[model samples]
Target chain A: MSDPIFTAENVKQHYLIRQGMFADPIVLRAVDGASFVLNRGRTLAVVGESGCGKSTLARMVTMIEDPTEGRMTIDGSEILPGAASRDAVLRSRVQIVFQDPYGSLNPRQTIGKTLMEPLLINRKDVPAQERERRAREMLDLVGLRPEYFDRYPHMFSGGQRQRIAVARALMLDPEVLVLDEPVSALDLSIQSQILNLLVDLQDRLGLAYLFISHDLSVVRHVANEVMVMYLGKPVEQGPKDAVFAAPRHPYTKALMSATPTADPSRRQERIKLSGELPSPMAVPPGCPFHPRCWRASDRCRKDMPTLEGDAHRFACFNPIEA
Target chain B: MTEITETPATATGPAHPSPLREFWQYFSDNRGAVAGLVVFAAFFLVAVFAPLIAPYPPHEQFRDHLLQPPFWQPGGTLQFPLGTDPLGRDMLSRLIFGARYSFFIGMVVVSIASFFGVVIGVIAGFAPSWLDTLIMRLMDIVLSFPSLLLALVLVAVLGPSLMNAMIAIAVVLQPHFVRLTRAAVLSERPKDYVTAAKVAGAKPGRLMFVTVLPNCLAPIIVQAALSFSSAILDAAALGFLGMGAQPPTPEWGTMLAESREFILRAWWVVTFPGLCILFAVLAINLMGDGLRDALDPKLKRS
Candidate 1:
């Protein structure tokens, strides 16, 4: 296979939690170790519950948050941590679609002004008039009318605001779009429309997506491969078909079983996992998911599992098939 | 997610006028602002046409007519509608000219303080950690002293005069504006528009002015209106204490201070000028209230 458009190697982020004035600070490993790669024209979905550090990993890949250890590279250049270089590279080649569509755009700015923001930032040798024309085209591409250029953010509906956000992201024509729960905030009906838009945009632009979300259904539709995270660590990953049809990791199986399918006639035998996800401050002794893993052996509690296998990696030594 | 920007709910509700028309709409909707405008206009007129309106030249003392009462008083003359002070100057004429002095002081002081404060505060707030820390620390050092006390010291050092008083007050007032502006810019700096501006590769200066400052204007404006009253009060207080405008200048507070000893013999001397101070401050506060209400986002929601 050709070189991946973006690749992360053993990315980790540790946050320092201060306890007392002069006391020693405790470190929470938010993103223990996450590794993933996205091809030129495909989406890689990182699926996890809240506090699972998927969002942190997304920030790391987008270079918003610097990793404690490991490196993330886009094309061939290694991205550095500090504000100046990270912001420059992130702004031009990669853009993030924040969670809240309403909040992502500045309230005071007009929609046209909002869409033109990234284009103005990167400049990219595009002529001013040509930039404006391209911005107008992007609005059309996102299914918005040309007239919205003068309106403020409050004037747009939630879904429409999200569309503006997506259009703003594409304005730079970035190679990678990091979507952090892009449609989770919208209404159920609106979610499908945004998903369809994303799919269509990916196909047309030949873009790569680092799709971060907790919703399995949306991921199944848009993602080529999926990585399941627990307590800031990836437990399972593989081609969407292999992972969904025959989930190797117990945590992955538990997550998929809980997702409600569209077909009412087909009843899934849901596998209920016991206990909440352990806090990042006090993750379980061995495997991060061991406390809630039914298939976890005594060794799973004593020693953590490591990702093994090719194409379809399962971190668990005693996976479901075992 | 695809946000449909073309046909927003608010976009179709009603056609909005151009920005100028929008400003007019805002002005019309706010009745207190209209009333404030009227009062300000009348005051401006009084200041401009002081000679035409006052019956006598301000310093042309009438030795025979010392301590003359107002026209409504028992021993009053129609020639002096408001009355005359112990110095035999027409209170009406002095008040008119005094309007010019007081209004000039307020505007000049506020403008100077606001301009410098806004620039410093925005720069401090938008800059990185070390710079922000350094600027804010300097502001804190200035803020450690009471503004009135600081202004008094500056006036004493600079030599007491109208221009010196204005400079003194502006010097003292600058720090407050800097703090207010810095806070306002800090709150607005994190907003997505600023982020967008950065993404657009806007220079730091352009982003601070074009993107950040406009959003922060509401609070700064409200603070300015409120500060106008304080500036007036401060200038008057300094004048009353003989540290501001010298004798014969007829500022309201100084007039009150001078006439307080003769208040029983001539009530109009102290009462009229006192009333002027009270009413002017009250009107400005009410105007500030109206402006705050109009600019508030919470009110817009309902």
Candidate 2:
């Protein structure tokens, strides 16, 4: 058992979008309710489709946006909905690596400046020479050369820039790092390199990671725990080996079956999900995934099921047999 | 994780030329631009050392050489090289001094316009929707009036003077910078780098001025160069209308106005001052085109 450093209880982010001048504003539940505890030295992977609010979850944890409704406890410091303080004390404990390395970095800033920005903004006590030293140290930690410090973001390739991004995130010595599709923008060969660097950084720093990605294969390699989401709500969540071995929720099963493997001799049936994700503006009556779930019965359409079971939790009326 | 061995993709990219050299490479690619730059440089130097370069005082008259033709002509002398105006003031000396006024007008007007425009624009871009709308609509209102008419009105209100003319021109030209900067800021504000800065504990002020502003500079730089030439033109127009630099100021436009009756007789006063204004505006516009080509990455041919 690991120590829980940050625990988010029933966190929700609902955006109010006004369609027209006369019509009433619609509430778009981007992240309906996600409750999970991030423990020390462990990676919790939030796996979902394009608009399942994985990035929203990461944004909430990284303090980019305040949650519409939630109670987050990070090391005794409480964060409430719409009242999340701009206090650097709590913010300095968490950092983020955004997707698109080219876009995430300030083009005008040099690598050293990018790495040093977090400290400059947050840690006022750190001296200039010490900040430079720490920045150079993190660069080497992320497998970049010392001379790359003075270079601009446009000069580096996707992989090198991702390395720089990772290095920049670690400058504040954050306890938690929210990695939002950290390698989704990189090449296939470069993805593994960044992944390895992330794993190495986690081990050395003992950092808790909230890794958000749609890629299952990458998630399987990095995550200790997995949370499968569909339409802003978690469908299944459990230990990495258990969820992959036996996905109880229909949505989770479909997602797990979709993960492509390179084995030719072993045959597996791919799960085909019909139709596109429904518009978040108008969700169905009962269970959000009921329309898409194969085991959808009359009961499932009327009443939504709560997440059950002790270790491997699932939210489904009729779950698949493990 | 196994040892990953692969050189970064951009490592092979044509040995990274310094940014200045790269800019020059693109700038010099256009032969017209190089010629324009050379001509602009000569004008700049002439402006800088006007007193030393000119043959005589710009205001000093040579009554003996009144209405004289160029030195190449029969009646002309080397002392009055480009010939004399209706008042016997040397056209060459006045034209040299006129360069200094043009540079001053352009610099002051552009600086004032861009500084206020960028500040207001950046604030508008980062402001709430209502504020942004209010600022944009106000700018639109300013743009609705014919620019020269608006400038003339401002100059008239301020009472005809050089400083007042420059200020009027700046106010008239400000809408362009505001529109340009606001557009740039609107596009660049939602970018990931700014978001990253916010996540890294950057305050709103820091995000607006430091993080987002620098990335939105390329377009503004191009717009600034184009505006610089226009500012000079507007100032000249004001001077021509007697709402700018007053009588005997040696301003190109004032010179043209003073020698208006001499157009048929002297020819040198009108022709020389008109040529100075024409060549200066042309050269600056050419350099601005070069700036647009070099600064805007999309317009650069692969």
Candidate 3:
């Protein structure tokens, strides 16, 4: 098989925040030791709660935040944080779509201007006529009429705005799209429409998607692979079907049980985990999920378990049997 | 056809009115702002055609008509309809000529201050390092002094003159633009659109000026209008203090200063000039308020 489109090796992003004048600074390990590989034409969903560092990982992939350690390679080219000198050409290969469609678009800019911005910035050689042609084509590809190009963002509904945002991201013809909860703010009906559109676009373009969302059901529909994160560490990762059907890690089981099922007949007893997410500044020793894991033992609290497996990998000493 | 149905839906569908027409609609709705617009237009026209409109040259004195009340008063003549100042210059003519000074000073000071302040603010807010710290600290030091006092001190040092007073006031006003723009840039810097712009391969300069600056303009514009009136007021204060527009000049503030002694006898001398200042400032302020309401999208009616 050919190489994956994107590869990250043990990426780590740490921030030192001073508590007070008299207190010592604490280190926030927002994304600590995360490694993953994403190939073309596949979706890798990073599932976690609000502060599990999923967004930070998206930032790393988009090169918005420089990792303190580790390395990332896009299309076999190494790129470093704060080193924009590396390759401007490689930078355009990856683009991100933010969560808030309203806030993600410049209100002052027309839809045509917003869509053409990436083309104008990245491809200076393209003529103005060609850029406009491509912008119209993108607008059509995203299910928006060509006339909508002249209107501003406020002229469109939430779902239509997100379609415009999607079109804008695709204007550069990027190979990888890092969608940061692209549909979380939309209505349920709108969410399904956008998801179907994304699937159709991915099939046509053969694009890789780094889908970051907290909704497990949404992930189940869109993702081929799943990586469960807790307190900035990946606890389990595997094919979506395998991981969802037979979860090895206790945290994954808890998460799966918490997801609401549409069919009442398939509804299972919900597993309620105790306590809130611990502060990333002071992560618990050993297994990060030990405080909340029902199967956590004295051994689980003494030594950290490393992720191990060929097709399915999980970081837990006591695994649930299939 | 789908296209035929879609066209009208897109045109009159949402609350997305054409920006220019929407601005006019909002502006015309406010009675005070409409009045202000009329007053400002009249003042602007008077300033532009001062030489043509004024019956006598601003400095030309009519010895017989000194302290003349007005055309409606017992001793007033139609030639000097508004009246004559203590210097015997036509009060109506000087007031017309004085509009030129007020408008010119306001525009010059605001333009210079806004340009420099916005440039510095965009840099400081976007860079966010030692440069940001240094620029903000300098702005803090400048802002520590009261605006009028700082202008007074600068005028004293620069040697008092109209041009010097304008320069002093611009110096006092530039920091406000810096603070305003910096605060705006700081808030807009972390917005998702800005990040999306960066990921789209926009360089820092383009992001700061094109993507971020346009979004920050509504507040800046409202501030500019409000500051225009303040600039005129500051210039008048300097003229009144004898630090701006020296003797023989018929600036409104200087006319008031010259007529203070005879105010009880000839009320028109100080009252007309004072009313000129009051009306001009009031009109501009009302227009500024209306602009603030019009530009904000949140305040728009669905």
* lDDT score for residue B262 of model 1: 96
Query: How many pairs in model 2 have backbone atoms within 3 A of each other, for residues 3 or more apart or on separate chains, i.e. clashes?
Result: 0
Q: Estimate, for each residue in A92-165, the C-alpha lDDT of model 3 and write its tens digit.
A: 78888999998999987999999999889878899999999999999889888777877777767788889889
List model 1 lDDT by residue over A1-322, tens digit each.
4348888889999999999879889899999988888887799999999999987887777665679998888886677776534365554777778788866777767888777766666675777888889889998998987877777777678899899999998888788998989999999878888999999999899899999999999999899999999889999988899999999898898898999988999998999989887789998888988888887789989998899989999899788873
Model 1: runs farther than 4 Å from truth? Answer: A1-3, A83-90, A124-128, B1-7, B11-14, B48-57, B123-146, B185-209, B296-302
Q: What is the lDDT of residue A28 in candidate 2?
A: 93
The CA lDDT of each predicted structure is: 0.81, 0.87, 0.87
DockQ of every candidate = 0.39, 0.60, 0.52
Error of 1 at B173 (Å): 3.7
Best by DockQ: 2
TM-score, structure 3 vs. true: 0.96
lDDT score at residue A56, model 1, on the 0-100 scale: 83
Q: Which is the better candidate, 1 or 2, if ranked by lDDT?
A: 2
Model 2 chain B poorest 10 in a row by lDDT: B5-14
Chain A alone, TM-score per model: 0.95, 0.97, 0.97
Clashing pairs in 3: none
Tens-digit lDDT track of model 1 for B15-64:
65565555556555878777876777677788788889877777689888
Q: Which runs of model 2 end up more than 4 angstroms from their true locations?
A: A80-85, B5-34, B264-266, B289-302
B121, model 2: CA deviation in Å? 0.8
Of 1 and 3, which scores higher on DockQ? 3
* Order by lDDT, highest first: 3, 2, 1
